[model samples]
Target: MLLLSRPMAPSNVVLLLIGLHGTGKSTFAKAATGQDVKVNPTGGVDAYTKECNKYTVDFKQRRFIIIDTPGMADQNTIEENLDVLQQVADQLQNLDQERVNGVIYFHSIEGARLSGVDRDNIRILKKICGDEFFPRVAFVTTRWDRIRRSEWDPILVPRNRDLETERMKLLPNGPSIFRFLNDGESHKAVLDYFAGLEDGTAANRGDKKARRSGTG
Candidate 1:
């Protein structure tokens, strides 16, 4: 239903996904869009590592233009991170009528603690999305299925809270944090979370390349 790929009209909502490489952004895109929507890495099926891909969601009375962007390396890829953010910004700027409705920044929960690299990545992301766009941004913790329920109960939940705390330090305006399983329900949850909110716009017009010294 979101097939009006040429240019978004006033009724459309442009959604964006941004995160570090291998954090399961593409995987979530494929699972969430289903077989009907075309997932990128356009060869045959489910190939990751493309620059950018677009998918659509047709709900009861709403349409969404989901932009899946390539993952950025938080370690030593300052230029690459800048390029990817620019790519997303360019696509968002193309919307003449609509504006960025929401953003999902993924964080894999495989690690036990947030490192300096993680801090750097979130800084760059904040820079890209601007300072006041937190209400529209959701920090989604991905790879939940990979963690054991027992471990989650004893370890993961606490760690997630700690991450949230640290996240607030960097992104004081960052919106709520949620866990994602990449399932049908999780997809709906993501949509519903944003659907409840008005289409909030993000002001990211300048060329604010995150500095290499965004080090933790």
Candidate 2:
């Protein structure tokens, strides 16, 4: 629910999206590109993304390339997950830029709790980004609109806290959590945050911005 007026980010900013199966990476990708980039419409456990793919969007005088990666599925074996990692590595090696500007990691709030697969996926994500890129990482939780208003305190509040704890473990001192309300403006707010980083205005004040945005 963060409201950011359009951003003036540097052109050709590349972003990497990673998360477990059904976490809404494809949805976010479509939202970022402002188009119906091919994605599995089935909202099921079947893994839709099998490799690294890119989608481009031109907004607010800035160009963004969103790289969506294959996610870990519950049925996947260790080798399969490793293969997914390899796919991402291959994409990175062939990227137009030397490094990705930011990473948008998705999580689903509709799930009752974080499963072991979620934890493993986070570990793999950490390995993918490493310590140096932590500052550029943002954690996005999807499906907020699916939750009812009556459950805000009893359900949503605790889940948000647990997710914040996980984020702190990875980002520690910097600001990072953003809610994906399944809308264009919400998606733009997230991209704007990273774009602000490129403009040098969001570096020191991200904590405040994050605080204002994480109120979902």
Candidate 3:
């Protein structure tokens, strides 16, 4: 597994977690990196918000920087929100391109129902990052513990349909989609996904490459 074999500490790679407030971005980050994780909430960016929080974890000799930005939807203009995302992009760009890795986009499983605000925020993110950014994006639907199977099935059915429709329209050949339970079994899937990335597992490598190459 990726987590098991990960370098004692990995350096030069950073993972940014993005999502709305109450979506569990911080929680997931903590789970992924453990304690000692740095969290700098948005502060000094504007009067409305503070600077964003950045946490670092050392694993397998590599230092993984995790950045958490405030929910953009709650902010005023699309431009202002984009500015925050841009700052993140700039920071990532400054890193060694080859070493800089991925982004985990979090969404509450209980809140997966698409909303106008979500659509707008997603559009803004895609616009700023471009289509190639798809490979680096991972959608994390959290709060599984709060949902029952009966409630989940029905909700996810339509939600997945809407997501597929939107992806087909906006990102026909986008990033890989892996579901995380956000509960008891959360670590398994998430760890596997991260491991796949680290070891370049055949399935993950092939699938992501195909998507990036526009052949999938």
Candidate 4:
């Protein structure tokens, strides 16, 4: 689970990546951490990551301790999911900062609508990170590469809007949202937003337009 162990950088940011299975949590973790980091392959219905994983990724002169957690709603029983939630809590508490700098919640644009499982996952995430952390959160939509190039304008834009709107309602104080194309620059766009937050450049609810413009 420890992808890299090295001397800490100047600024160490702890980020929690949360979402359901197949939402590209591991993919992002492996890419951001490094190509050498061994991450579980993404596929199928069941979740491959069974517990919380911690990876150290250096980007733009910042060190990000990414805690990639198990997919919500993958467990058969509510009690089992609760146990995973406890695991996430434990990891957060164990951090040297004892606080998370930001949270990235992933969802696949492939699903046209948010199902019951999706809502349930969001609810569980709220419990894990708490309401005060909402402003530091980013609701990211992934798998844009799956859509055809010709449909990018017509299909991709509107879908992103709908997804953003829907997630806004679920999260309080309006956490910034962005699309993840599964690439490096896109990854930096997300990190840049959180980095801004860390440095006091971005404020919750006030810089919504600035956040969207940075990614757009």
Candidate 5:
């Protein structure tokens, strides 16, 4: 519920990562946190695991904690997965609302189409975090190199547009929408997105910030 006007010192914030499996959530968390990943207990207050890991990073005298939850689109019972997500939402609420800043939602270029599982997961996330959650959410499309421009462009155009529409419909006043392609070239863009979020700039605001701040 706390909207950061500027990126707080890393010491003052926590970031939560949510996406489907094989979406590069772990890789991103490791890259961002620079720590041994820790998984929350399955039955604890933060019982969101099976690849859902947590890590911490310190920058500019600030500490940033990131909780990486399992990819929702993985092979798991929808009920079980939703339960874990709910638990995560509860934990966030228990934490200082402001301490938990943004969420990175991963989407794979290989599987760009929103599947049934993805729709359900997003619904659950919206139910738990509220409609504005999407603005604070960034869509990270992984496996970009594997997608050919000839095939990817057309698929991506409508997909991206539909996704934005759905997200807005789900969370009419959400944070903001930002998109990124994951590949060798996209590495910097992905990093800049998070860094911008860390620095209090909404990474989804525009292409300019994304271009200037990304690590790729």
Candidate 6:
């Protein structure tokens, strides 16, 4: 079966979004891509996004191609996640500089700390992308508007610190962290970081495709 709804053009800068279930991958995708994506509300309770959805937009004279992948979790079974990963892996191999640009990893404050599934998913990501892919990854904590600074000291601060200290090892040298759905333009800031890396060329290491695990 085809993973993408439509054919990806050569000029698209593909950005893959992955995170734990309920991390608001869909919400962030909608906000960042400016596309009214259809998010399942009932069956969505588990996978939310049953399949990978691609949204294309124009940003800063460059095409912003966002691939919103299904959230990874245990409830859906390891087989389910693997199936999606296989499709993603197969698709990425065909894309060049016009392909994958970076990874946007989403986390949430609703949890007391990152869960086991979260850690497992990160491991899978590392396996697929390889160590060098770390620099292109962005670790983002979404849904920050749920609380205020006063409410964070006893709750969100320790959690955040622990994530950066231990959990962030998912990305080598620790990928840059950001607050999405909280501060305005934070999403743009991430894309901007990659944009600056352009250096008037996309043929360098900056444009190289990420490594993926063999599927099948």
Q: List the residue pairs that clash in candidate 1.
A: none
- Which TM-score value belongs to model 2? 0.79
Better candidate by lDDT, 3 or 4: 4
Mind giving the per-residue lDDT tens digits that candidate 1 earns over 29-116?
7776674433333322233655556787775356777878776665646665666677666654554322466677778888666655
Candidate 6, residues 1-216, lDDT tens digits: the string is 223211255445568888766677777777777788765443235756766777877776667778887777646555676676776666555443224667777888666666766676667767766777666666776666666757666776566667666545666444445556434355665565555444343322211121111000
Candidate 5 regions exceeding 4 Å error are 1-10, 34-51, 58-62, 74-78, 86-99, 132-134, 148-158, 175-177, 180-216
Q: Which stretches of candidate 1 lie over 4 Å from their true place?
A: 1-10, 36-47, 90-99, 199-216
- Pairs of residues at least 3 apart in sequence or in different chains that clash in candidate 2: none
Candidate 3's TM-score: 0.64
| lDDT by residue for model 3 (119-147), tens | 66678756656676555556665565455
Highest TM-score: give the candidate number.
Answer: 2
Model 4 has a clash total of 0
lDDT, residue 83, model 6: 71
> Would you list the rank order by lDDT, best first?
2, 4, 6, 1, 5, 3
By TM-score rank, best first, the candidates go: 2, 4, 1, 6, 3, 5
Candidate 4 local lDDT, 1-216, one digit each (tens): 112112244488778787777888887787677755444455554656776778887776788888888777654455665666676776655654345667788888787767676777677666665677666778887777677767766786677778777887888664556777765656766777777666767544322442344333
Model 2, CA-based lDDT: 0.69
Q: Assess candidate 5 and give its TM-score to the true structure.
A: 0.63
Evaluated against the true structure, the overall lDDT of model 6 is 0.61
CA lDDT, candidate 3, residue 182: 42
Q: Each candidate's TM vs. the true structure?
A: 0.74, 0.79, 0.64, 0.79, 0.63, 0.73
Roughly what TM-score does model 1 have, to 2 decimal places?
A: 0.74
Error of 6 at 121 (Å): 1.6
Candidate 6: C-alpha RMSD after superposition: 8.7
Query: Cα RMSD (Å) per model?
Result: 9.5, 5.8, 8.4, 5.1, 6.4, 8.7
Off by over 4 Å in 6: 1-11, 40-44, 76-80, 90-98, 182-184, 200-216
The TM-score between candidate 6 and the true structure equals 0.73
